[model samples]
Target: MVRERKFSDEDLFLATKELLLDYGYEGFTFGLLAERLGVSRSALYKYFGNKEELIMEFMMYELDQFMDKLRKINDYNRFEDQFDYLLELLMNHPQIHQLIEIGRHVPVNNQKLKEKNDKLDGLHLDMYQSLVGFVQQGKGEGKLKPHIPDTLIVGYILQSFLVPNFAQIPHSEWVQSIKEIIRNGMFTDDH
Candidate 1:
């Protein structure tokens, strides 16, 4: 039987965040984390049991932070402003962007990890829905074309935000271009 070990969840979270940032998702591992913490392999195992749990924990932490940031933008009365804020938040967290990219392509062996991914998917779907609601609102206010479906607009915005090769372009410039495109293409004439 494996003995459980106690470690600071905050420490583990920060360690995992730094590891994912430094090594990216593909290169991050428990052994590397243990080495960083100057702990033995067994000690690391006692704390996390496996890498998948660590990754999921980190993902959840990031998701919570993301939602919190979104919630704080309650003052933005316009959908375009909210969308721009969302883009800005994502652009600032490129490591998380990379982690998500890694998560999408990597295969997982555990059911819990799969479930966590499902939950993450649901969370993202909810965010997309919120954005679509804004788009629908814009349509009602004659701020967007009624002909364009909400799903397509949301999907396009997501694709623009989550591109795999974001490291190549300066994020500020990319964001500006994205905002410009979204304004010209999606926002209503009043924009």
Candidate 2:
């Protein structure tokens, strides 16, 4: 007889995200997830065939949440405000970048996995599309340089998140410095 599931998906995904961020993909396992959820490993196995499947499922949830938050970029009227919001979101979810990189290691040996991977790639493009609109608006308003290509500007801003806070500087100061560099050129204004 099929036993009713004990945990809600919110609980499952929440636990999955925490574990994934804490231990990362290499360290994450169904046993760990089950233990975190206070359930038996067999209970998890009944839902997911293997660790990869469970991870992928959790990733889908994660991406959806991210996209929802990304959509809020339109809410900020000012170009700098939008840029700051995006940076804050990226900072708050730094693990997302690492998790996505780890996703490439997921073995897409079956149709389901392939489709999920494909969907993730598509979602990435969707995110870029939203950012492109933001960049285009900035160019139109003369807030961003028109000479530079939009793709490059978008790439620069997104890649800026990967910059390390090597000096262990305070958070607000570091973010402000990054914002200054992103808005103005690295050189002093006199240049």
Candidate 3:
């Protein structure tokens, strides 16, 4: 007889995110996920046809959570506060940018995968638009320099997450350095 599912979809997605981050796309496997979740491979197959579909679904769920958090940045009154909050949020999810990069290259072989990919693309666009809106708000408040393009600022912020941690600096110090570089630029005011 087929066994009932003990874990919810959210639990599976959370575990999948952890595994994907631990082992990149090339290394991730259904067997590993099933093992990690304490379920058989057949149990996982019931929800997703293949690894690609499962990963895509997880990406969609993650993006949804991310967008929800992004929208909440407006709750803060000051743009600087919002910027700090955004930075903290990004720092907390170190693997998200990598996952997004992987998602871009994931092949969509079937109609369902195609539809899911389109939805993921839409979520990505919404996330970008939310960032642009945040930038615009900062500009309106005269906190962000009007001379800089919104896309450039957004790109810089997003790419900052991918900065190499080769030095093994403390997380707080590293994040502070990033905030300083992004907000103040690399040049000293004394120059």
Q: Which candidate wins on TM-score?
A: 3
Q: For each candidate, what TM-score against the reference? A: 0.66, 0.77, 0.86
Any idea what lDDT model 3 has?
0.89
Ranking by TM-score: 3, 2, 1
The models' CA-based lDDT, in order, is 0.70, 0.82, 0.89
**Candidate 3 local lDDT, 145-178, one digit each (tens):** 9999999999889889888899899999999999
- Model 2 residue runs over 4 Å out of place are 1-15, 18-27, 31-41
Off by over 4 Å in 1: 1-11, 18-26, 73-75, 95-98, 105-118, 161-174, 185-191
Distance from true position, residue 159, model 1, in Å? Answer: 3.8
List candidate 3 segments past 4 Å from native.
1-7
Candidate 1 lDDT by residue in tens digits, 110-174: 78778877887776666556667767867877878889888887666656665565467776677
The lDDT leader among the candidates is 3
Error of 2 at 189 (Å): 1.9
**Among all windows of ten consecutive residues in candidate 1, which has the lowest summed lDDT?**
94-103
lDDT ranking of the models: 3, 2, 1
Candidate 1: TM-score? 0.66
Higher-lDDT candidate of 1 and 3:
3
